[model samples]
Target: MRRMLTVCAAVAVAGTVVAAPAMAVAGGEAAGSGAAPWMVTVAFKGDEPLVQRESCGGALIAPDRVATAAHCLDHVDPTHLEVHVGGGTLSEDPGKVVPIKGWSVEPGFRLIPSPVDPQDFEKSSAADDVAVIKLARSVFGVPTLPVARTAPAPGSTVDLFGHGLTQAPDPKNPAAALGDQLKHAQLKVLDDGACAAGLASPGLLDGKSVLCTQGAATVCPGDSGGPLVQNGRLVGIVSFGGETAGKQCGEPTVDGFADAAVARSFLTQPRPPLAPMAAADPVITGTKAAGDTLTCEAPKWTIKPEKTEYAWYYNKVDPANGFEFYLPVEGATTPTLKVTDELAGHKLNCGITASTAGGTILQYSDVF
Candidate 1:
């Protein structure tokens, strides 16, 4: 059976490689930062610089919001994600990093496993794979790309842009880096019958929710959530790719995107309540010595949380492994924790979990 990958947009996660549902410009030319000023770099907080953490690409659809593929963030925590906008050819520029406040995936979104091998993601496909992200603050000066009111005709040509792999990742070259510069490609829209005929999982393409395409140049990993533009408006988001003949690069297979028009309602709908966002980390006050009472204050949040909860933990030294580990104190759900002799010689810390209708977030304070 032929392989159809989700473009592997996400980088290594805790040492495991996950196929990201985005693509990059393969057999295409480099694009300037101005080429798509509304372009966005979706990334996670990591030890590396923001540019090095590029997971998926996105397009700014509102002053304080961006549109991307749901798979790129469906299982991800909003607090750990950030968007880089208004950058140069690079993944990020000075002062362009914006933390994600919250996000919502299309209610109907689903990922279909390959009939040949469920363990193999190279043959996986998706349905209704779109999402909208709320930024911590509004970004001015840059122009936002409006979602197309209707799907483009099958024979029409469209452009795709992204910060993804320039070519299919080689198994032999596992250390190869992802594309840092943005790039663009032109592809022709494919009709439903033509699209299904070329895909390993044709049943996943409903024609309305998916926009199919093909061309000499195509999208590779990291391009997921990147914009597919027709006449200056967003028509689709890079979703997945399939190989009918050649490799995963140029002219290799049919590509799929989350139809922007089909997702218009979810994209343009009124904003919902945002997940809890902390302005500061939790603070632990009081003496560290045993027999002293310690109080942990909830971190200030931009939006008031509906509820706040706390937990106390102690770092203990294990005599067997000689390694330190943390253990939660029993019934430490209040704002105060009374230290006892048993906690002596152990480091203590507090965690505050803030929750709202939108989502929940947990923040921990430095060890006391």
Candidate 2:
């Protein structure tokens, strides 16, 4: 049976229009265990070093890629975007800062009016609110999360993470705003029909590409683009949240997530070849001395490979002629190769080709 759906841009208010900021997790606790290594804090570059502002949250799905909300970078310049990984708070030096090189937003993405009014909900669509950012250099040593191929079953429990506000906004006190510390909460996925019914605008839930959650925990401004993980995989990106009768953040209301499966292909695209010792470059580990055993280590990839092939090449030494010649090393097909005395004076290099669901990538190690 086909389902009827409605659309919304941000939190809906009766008469006032409030522009939604990057959201956060309300009714949640501080993230102390550092459970989410892929969680990143997105901020604007300031004039001084280590100075950043206008923060948002994102997920590191690849060594050089971050998944976020399209609205977060809609009007911002790419050069001004700075990403901080492996941190629970903005003040912590969990990881180094990397500048954004480029980004791609879903073609179907459209901005919802700021301070969205109740009537605006009838005109906006949140189905394609996702985007991916390409970093100037790869992020190494930290773990990257994977996007779910399928949606989690309704009623399943999911974990939401963000560096947003702990309390609802208070108009009387401007200081009562969003949080800077990363927080998380557990939320239960809601059925499409029930999610739609809970909203003031009944047609706001797009069943296929968007889903909602229930319970005391909900996402608020500053949490946009954060990950909704289920069964240890990212299943959604925080898109928007519904308001309660009193126009507060919490239960009887639902928060929306852009279905990860709908944008998995774009999020996991293979990156360009990296420089030596960079994130995705193959490593040749072992001593260069004769008779020593050498092994080729495959570069870490966003997507695991189905198969891998290795080839060893020798740059033969020519005493009389200055010209260099590269000759294939016989019987060195696997990842490991033996260093022979006959090739002691020759330069040695290894080529590794990895085949993944996304595509193929070839990388070479430095000569030993």
Candidate 3:
């Protein structure tokens, strides 16, 4: 579930050396600092001080939907991972843990090879370094941010946050203790035109999804699933850094996918124009069906059902006024919806919207 690219492979692109300037950064405090309220600290299995620690820069994509890198939760239980939203401290209670019901990692991204010799085909790189987390309960009371489905163009200014950046260096084994810094840095977007140079020159970039510029402050290992906010919208997820295998942050290397092409409508479900989407399956040839007696159904293809809201529209416009929903209702379910007043050829539109408990999401689907 994490971005996997051996240090050696990153130097070669289609077997060609990357021809860019080496990225360097002195490890201390790199980019973001202070208590990032929106920074989510994720832990697994309730281990001592928490088994493993990873900082996922989440923006409360939905009250129940958190977008992070798949690798952040690799080998960790989705249901058991404790999510501390809007805070810097870790959650103490096990019940506060949000169980992840479902998620889809970049289909081809994998670290453990499918076979042996396993080169680029099955590897996890920047190509698909992004993923999302679906929580059992909605993250209410917090304000979720917005996502930019597309990457920011090169030279775009961005901001990032995380729960890691500093650790007491391991003196006995210098390499062991010299981990990543949790904050600080200035970044700009690089062009995808030079992928060979991009990959060859070092820094945390892959040939697949993004192109980042690591400067004074760069993202480190624990910061893997964090968000890269730009122009007030989340444009990318921090996936890698350029520090040498044995070394820590130094030089000016940028993280990968500065301008990630995120899906604008990635969090939405499908809406339908008519209800009873295959009510009697067979349709019974021709009978004056009574709409009132039929059962109503949920929307079809609810992509991020956990982050959606539902409403039935009689025609192409508004059903009523008063309440406009952003969060989802508890009642509806599945591919079928019954018509309140069945008509031979009347058009009924259903509005299915995907949203975060904080009120952010992929997009709203309209059916009629």
TM-score of each: 0.69, 0.61, 0.53
lDDT by candidate, in order shown: 0.72, 0.65, 0.43
Candidate 2's residue-wise lDDT over 1-368, tens digit each?
A: 00011112223333322222434333445666567888877776776423136356788988889988766655343544678887665655435677766665665555443233544543343666777888879898888888899988888998888765444445664333445456777888888888877665555566767878866566655677888898778898887764322344332357778888888876776753221222456788998778988898876654455767899989965789878878889989988888889766678889876553323345678787
Q: Arrange candidates by lDDT, highest first: which order?
A: 1, 2, 3
Please tell me which predicted candidate would have the highest TM-score against the true structure.
1
Which regions of candidate 2 fall more than 4 Å away from where they truly are? 1-27, 47-52, 111-125, 171-176, 243-246, 250-252, 271-368
- Write model 1 residue lDDT over 1-368, tens digit each, in one string: 21212222212222222222234433455665478888888877787866467788889999988998877866454666778885555634523787677876777777777665666655577788888888879999889999999999999999888766554555665324356666777888999999988787566566768989887666665677888999999999988874322235433578888999999988888876565666677899888777888899776676677888889999978899999989999998899988899876788999877766554566788888
Task: Judging by lDDT against the true structure, name the best candidate.
Answer: 1
Tens digits of per-residue lDDT for model 3, 115-171? 222343322244455555666577666666677766776776666665443322234
Measured on C-alpha atoms, candidate 1 has an lDDT of 0.72
Order the candidates by TM-score, highest first — what do you get? 1, 2, 3
lDDT of 3 at 340: 37
Whichever of 1 and 2 has more lDDT, that candidate is: 1
The count of backbone overlaps in candidate 2 is: 18
